[model samples]
Target: MMSALEADFGQTPSQTVGPYFAYGLTASQYGYDFDQPFDAVLALENARGERIRVEGRVIDGDGNVIGDALVEISQPDGEGRYPQTVDEARSSGFRGFGRCGTGTESGNRFVFHTVKPGAETSGEAPHINVIVTMRGLLLHTFTRIYFSDEAGANANDAVLQSVPADRRGTLIAERVAQDGAVRYRFDIRMQGDGETVFFDV
Candidate 1:
């Protein structure tokens, strides 16, 4: 399981960044189940590793903030899904799916404060793929989270289909909604959702 799973669209051809501190991953896990269109901009860290205040507006099905929901990010590396030691978690971060970095200009470094993406091509498909880059690691790796709500979709996702049948369930996320919002927080277990292998391309 890749920790710190963030989603960012391909650059629009005009974004540039310099080196900065890593404050770990910002939590943008979705807690809404309806067809909500939310737009959120989570905080970005300064060179000092402080949380710069930012806003994430949860969009309603009509494309508006039902109200604003705030999210906090936990360490993206190994909170148990990807197991590592406390000391190692401090020194390296990800000892499973990936490692943190000092931000790069290439296609590797990525960060976002967007809602958990509904699966592509199928609403029931409850999962999103991720690329992880933590300390001591150099390659972008792939992992997934499946939605418990969408079993049929999980069964049909082309990528999920590609994996061995038994291995497929490892990526499923439990969908639990509360306070009128849909929430799916499936931490990736570095040992494959507690014990499985991830991928890199």
Candidate 2:
């Protein structure tokens, strides 16, 4: 027989991220209502930047939309400087972050009103760091949204360079013009063919 200390300590199986995340992680559900939609704006009053819209759908392996997915994004200000604190962010009018849920009726679409992020650090292209969470996800998925317009900068970005050439396009957002507004579409595919290029971090 194995000694008490020598006996194996079985590990617990991992659990999925949600079904409850919508009620728990959201601002309105958390009792902090801003009286506006979740994707309203990242920068406030005095924030300096060219306002733009980023919208996309979250699709699953089978090409079905995942309506309940929650998306969170972080990006630097137009000048490429990130706000260091809450107070600084509010005072400077630069939120530098935003979150939104993919409503079921809207075909799992999510949108964000924000400025185009600039290159803060050298060798890093202007990109938004994205995190996605949903009911069946064991952990949040991470990826970067690169601008299709920045071909030159993107060509030199270390992270972009690391991705295989054929798959690199999965990370770039397509620029579009609609209703006199500029928008970028960046769909996230959870699995199967054409899966978005996710990072290890």
Candidate 3:
């Protein structure tokens, strides 16, 4: 009797988003806008916490800028409380979420202006969850952006500890300041050396 595993079977071809993805996803390009706001301005006025800037670039395996990648980030307010409802988010001036598309002309650079997030809980370190989507990706990738300034908290963070010691630096963002305003720089590498540490979730 022949084993079932001995039979030859064809493999399915992988699918890709291909070109022209922006027509449906990007509002500024084709006006198909989602109901929620994409910019990270949690509030226009009376918003709590210190305002900060986050910026970065998206690069591919070959070291070329992706140029059209879309990044979404979810973070709590400075107090670490997420709004329970859309109405509450709007009223409390806590957007707690944002999406940004890398610039095609500007070499895949993205920027977000929002308040510095606090720890979600007493024990957890302050971090922002990120999701990336782009052409050629069969599934989206997930990662976390950690603050370099939180050395003590990061050392004790459960999630950070779970990652391999050598790869943990990929998740930490570099801190910079301009004109007295704080900024964090985090670059995403899709593959190859120095590739970002993506999470299973």
Model 1 agreement with the true structure over 110-179: per-residue lDDT tens digits: 3233234333343335344444333222333466655566677666677778888877665665555567
Q: Rate the local accuracy (lDDT) of all candidates.
A: 0.37, 0.82, 0.78
List the candidates' TM-scores in order: 0.41, 0.84, 0.84
Root-mean-square deviation (CA) per prediction: 20.2, 7.5, 7.0
Candidate 3 has an lDDT of: 0.78
| Segments of candidate 3 deviating more than 4 angstroms | 1-23, 29-37
Q: What's the lDDT of the predicted structure labeled candidate 2?
A: 0.82
Alpha carbon lDDT of residue 6, candidate 3? Answer: 88
Global Cα lDDT for candidate 1: 0.37
Residue 116's lDDT within candidate 1 is 40
* Backbone N/Cα/C clashes per model: 22, 0, 0
Q: Lowest lDDT 10-mer window, candidate 2?
A: 10-19
Error of 1 at 74 (Å): 18
Model 3, residue 191: distance off in Å is 0.2
